[model samples]
Target: MATAVFPYLPADELKKAEDESNARELSWFLDNLQEKLAEFKHGLEDCYARLSPLEDPESSTLVISTPKSELVKGHVTRVGTRVVKGSLHLRLKTLPSLHLKLSETSPLILPQLSHLRTLLNNALDCVDITRWTGDRHSAAFITSQLHLLHSLLLEAQNVLTGPSFPVPRPGTPHPLPIASRTSGEDGNEHNPPWYQCIPDPNTFAPPVPENLSLHLIPTTSSLILTIRVLEPTAVPPSAFNKFALAIGAQRRLEHDEMDGVFMWKGEEVKVKEKVRVESGGDPVLLVLGVKLQSLEKGIEGAMMSLRAVMGLSQEKDDD
Candidate 1:
């Protein structure tokens, strides 16, 4: 028999090497876990700050209360070194609620909250990572608690900022200047061509007796007009066959169909043609567009003229 050039390690030595490798991996996992926990803790604090003002009873204007009658309760029990049970109650204002269960055994005793307020206070407090022993069980338990607390804080923030909460009323719409070309023959800043044209609200007429309205939105390159019919009824035999829209004489866009876009000076406006008549319940959506520069050059007068053609505006007879 000849001696082997390479010899296999004994079973005991092999097992020791395997154990050391696992220990190193576990240490890396614990470090990562601590970092994640710290990040979550910071986020929890910020969310709680945003929600705290609404929690004050004196801040009635900003507060939305969930009724006690709506509260739903759930419980989780764990049988381990020592039996532990936890209860959670949720009061939800909207449909669909939340439920949670905890089954893992924790190495350290977990904190208990007497009520929602206590839970929120605890979540807002700094997480003490010094107590974490870098053990897998401790990491799991801490992470789970942080996640639950984060969810609760998020829910509180949502409730505080929800649409049901009262908000300050908005003021009147302010007119914004049309976007102008920065450098062009027509765009001399010192002696710029008169391009500021405001739409005469007087001449602005929507489809009458048909529950139709028109809204204009101005952009950097063009003016967009949206036409909507609030009510759709069956089209009468005398319904207008074609819908025409124009902004500042750049070009007239005529469409007999339900929707189309009109282009002018490289700018486009869109409009919907179909009126929601009784047979067709779909609301008429017509979008139209025109170049912003065209609008600056007294294009509103052209729009008024187009309105007259569509029977949307009547020219006052100069008596």
Candidate 2:
């Protein structure tokens, strides 16, 4: 009598209903999980991109606020093809600077920019979405992965602005040595041909033929100086060389033999004394100085020549 009142549903119908329910539940879970994951991933990607030197051709600036409301500012400027200038303005009064030049063997460990873009499109390749039922463990695992990604981004930033640049860690395997392992023709293992062991200067020095130029832009109350290589692509691995600037009758305004270039404010020009110029005569001369060893040929003074034209217009008294 009970069986007749409640007829049994067919096995196929029961199986179909169960599958449909599972599909709906899985879809809803994936939607929520993916949304969260995507938001986190986007934030990390943005941070990575902002700090990546390769992504920024002009410059990359990052300002991170601390818990104490202080700001730590950092910037990386591409000076040449192989050279990059970095500056960090910490909470302290003094600012630190870094000059990095990538060599042929240097490793740019920051992964390609597209790595995170496709992370979600194929992230589930090995993941079984059906098994993820919004369990606490599953959520925790996702969160861990996001944290790892964030850590990687932070590491990249540190590599750029850290006190020291990244170098190959010891114990890494090296290619086979070109020198003979056994004794040389001299029958001495210690004595190898100079050519075989001599380090190449080109490996660390600037290119043989270099072209550098300097220009000045005058503002309302300041002067902006810019130095750039004409052939940036040809520049080899090099350090931040020195520069000297002279204004008005070859008077040295600023000079540094070993340091990175910094933006010079007009007030910091440090003029020794005021020059007595003829009221209606030639303009003052501005000379761009360079080290003799840095260039093969002397740069034409005319190339960096700038005329400081100062004139006081006299008004006739109107009666």
Candidate 3:
């Protein structure tokens, strides 16, 4: 077996080898998830900072109550994380709302807020890879990235609402730019394999051949990964469906038909009538609806189209 460049192993031996490989991948995935969760927790602590003041005088407030009369107070509040109605008393030890965590600290610099909004663009780049870029990755790896992306986006949102806030912990302290040809996703840095044409977010992804279309849809409770099959009429659409079904089968998949490890899943969504699949994480749940485009004799090979949509599972929202 070692001597031949392309050697074949006995069936049972091959299956055993494949099993060992899959176990290793699964182990790696779980470790990564744990690492990311730890990072997320750390980010919550890191997210603490000051909220910038706004108009309505009622709009912004000191995120951290100093419990001092002389210090600037009241008339400042975040939209959702409002200031204590009348006055915050020194005697009353009230636990600030969880949203308060987002309001943490004070005196956030305008530049820092700008940086927070920038981090989101970086997350979008991470997402685009899962859709285009045609990278070869297992569902676990992609799903882990999605979770990280979501956590990071929340951090960025604090800044976007009234000011740009940092996802400081959920991702790298300073987000790196994804290669976006002349203009990078991070705005400053441009990476390799740069091209001239920018992808249109409104329409289905432009690259139609030999590529996987990844969709990241944020739901109330959890983020849902939607992988769209390339237009079946122009392409085979086999690879895309295999990815979707493989993810769906993971939740139970008694047959053990899939090649790799079983991983993340969440509340289900109906992709097609009577066809429900997990809403969050990968393997992403997608319904491949194939319909004849044209039956005319002149039509070449076959004609079909692929469609995708996102939904939430109320019982288990990521929110």
Which candidate should be chosen as best, given TM-score against the real structure?
1
In model 2, where is the ten-residue run with the lowest total lDDT?
281-290
Better of 1 and 2 by TM-score: 1
- Write one digit per residue (lDDT tens) for candidate 1, span 34-139: 5555655555444333223222321111111122443334332211111133333333332224342222332111111112234345654525532253344453
Candidates arranged by lDDT, highest first: 1, 3, 2
- Candidate 2 on 1-319: residue-level lDDT in tens? 3343236668898888777876566445445555544444444344333334353442322222223433333333221112233333333211122222323443222121223223322323212331244342343344344334434434322222212112323344222132332111121222222122222234322321122222212111112222222222223323322222222333222212111121122111111111111111101111101111111121111111101011112231111
**Number of the top candidate by lDDT?**
1
Better structure of 2 and 3 per lDDT: 3
**Candidate 3, residues 259-308: lDDT per residue as tens digits?**
11111122111111010012222110011000011111111111110000
Badly placed stretches (over 4 Å) of model 1 are 1-7, 54-118, 129-319
